[model samples]
Target: MENAERKELELFAAKMRRWIVEGVYCAKSGHPGGSLSCTDIICYLYNKEMKVDPQNPKDPDRDRFVLSKGHCAPALYSALGLKGFFDINEMKNLRKIDSFLQGHPCIEHTPGIDMSTGSLGQGISAATGMALAAKLDGKDYRVFSVLGDGEMQEGQVWEALMSAAHNKLDNICAFVDHNGLQIDGNVDDVMSLGDIKAKVTAFGWNAVEIDGHDFDQIEGALKAFNENRGSGKPFFVIANTHKGRGVSFMTDNASWHGSAPKEEQYNIAVGELDAKIKELEG
Candidate 1:
């Protein structure tokens, strides 16, 4: 990417971080660490990678995204809002009664959501199914799914991984948010996902590891996957990321995993994000 485009992505990521923090703080009960960690990846996909239409959201040939780490709904919701999926003001209503934005994603209730997912390990299965359906229908649409490293403890994820590889779903790309932390604590301490790349590669998928927050590496990986599609394999991008990426106090702090920021903390996060946004604008 050019310097200008890179700056644009950086600005988008910064704005997304602010939105995630604001949305979670407003709700007073939502995931922040995972949301912050995954913001850049989400911005990359929604802003540049995915072939989507906010205007024609239900277009059959449009690409699909599944947030397998469904607790990170705040990140997805913020992205959707910025992408014009809904009014930006709706973000403040997150996790409230009768709001389209639920604590976990619900496709029926949400506009841009392709799948209703909250269960730890069920989303990958839905994404695999979508990819299979596209193949059966001979459509060129691709499917992307993001999973939390901790959520890999669920056996159902392995089942979906095996299925995607066995069926040779080349149009499907999955990401592992290897942030090293979960709700309770670190993933390695809670339940080690030993050699995630090796495990997926053994299941017959093309796997690449990259710094999840690096735009250049992420763009390169996605481009490479697109170039190699239909080579009789699935694609996995292992995104090594900080648990709470942008905020100084929250980074890698397990306590922030699901905690809403207090008022003072919210002001700090918003201030930091606003300064970055202003710098980009300048």
Candidate 2:
């Protein structure tokens, strides 16, 4: 990426982190760790990868994205708001009693959500189905999704993977947010998803591992996904990320997985992110 583009992405990701902290703090409950971990990918997708229009969010030919790791709705929702799907101030109402932006994605309510997902391994299944449907309909639109590393333990996820590869759904690209931590202390401790890349490759996906925080690597892997469109195989990107990124106390800490920050911690997080944004601007 060019210096200007990289700087723009950095600033956007910082602002999104602030939004994540703000929403969770105001709601007094959420999964901030994974949300922060995946914010960059969401930033890149909404900014550079996906073909989405805030004015016509449901255009049939537009690319589709599913947050397979749907608990991180704060990140996805913020990306949508930043891209003008709705008012960015709407984030303050996240998870509120009457807010359309609930804790998880709901396609019925949210404009940019292509799939309503929160039930663990089901999002990938839906994405795979969407890919197959697109092929059947002779459409060129692609399907993109993100999965939690801990969610790799699900048998249903493997089933979806196998089915996608078996049917050669090359139009689909997905990533594993391998943050090494889940709500439980560590993902490997709770359940070891040994050699995630190898496992998915064995399942017949064209897979690659990369630093999830790095925009260049993310774009490279996504380019590889695009190249595989006619190769009769699906693409899986194993993105190594920190569970709680962009905040001091929360970074890599599993406790922040399903808990909101207190007022002091929230202030600290917002302060740090604001500083980063300022530096990027400078």
Off-target runs (Cα >4 Å) in candidate 2 are none
Q: What's model 1's lDDT at 43?
A: 92
Q: Write the per-residue lDDT of candidate 2 for residues 1-282, one digit (tens) a residue.
A: 898999899899999999999999999999999999999998998999999899999999999999999999999999999889999899999999879999999999998999998999999999999999999999999999999988888899999999999999999999999999877788889999998888999999999999999999999999998888899999999999998899999998899999999988988998998999899989
- Runs off by more than 4 Å, candidate 1: none
TM-score of each: 0.99, 0.99
- Model 2, CA-based lDDT: 0.93
Cα lDDT computed for each candidate against the true fold: 0.93, 0.93
lDDT per residue (tens digit) for residues 131-206 in model 1: 9999999999999999999999999999999999889899999999999999899898998999998999999999
Q: How many backbone collisions does model 2 have?
A: 0
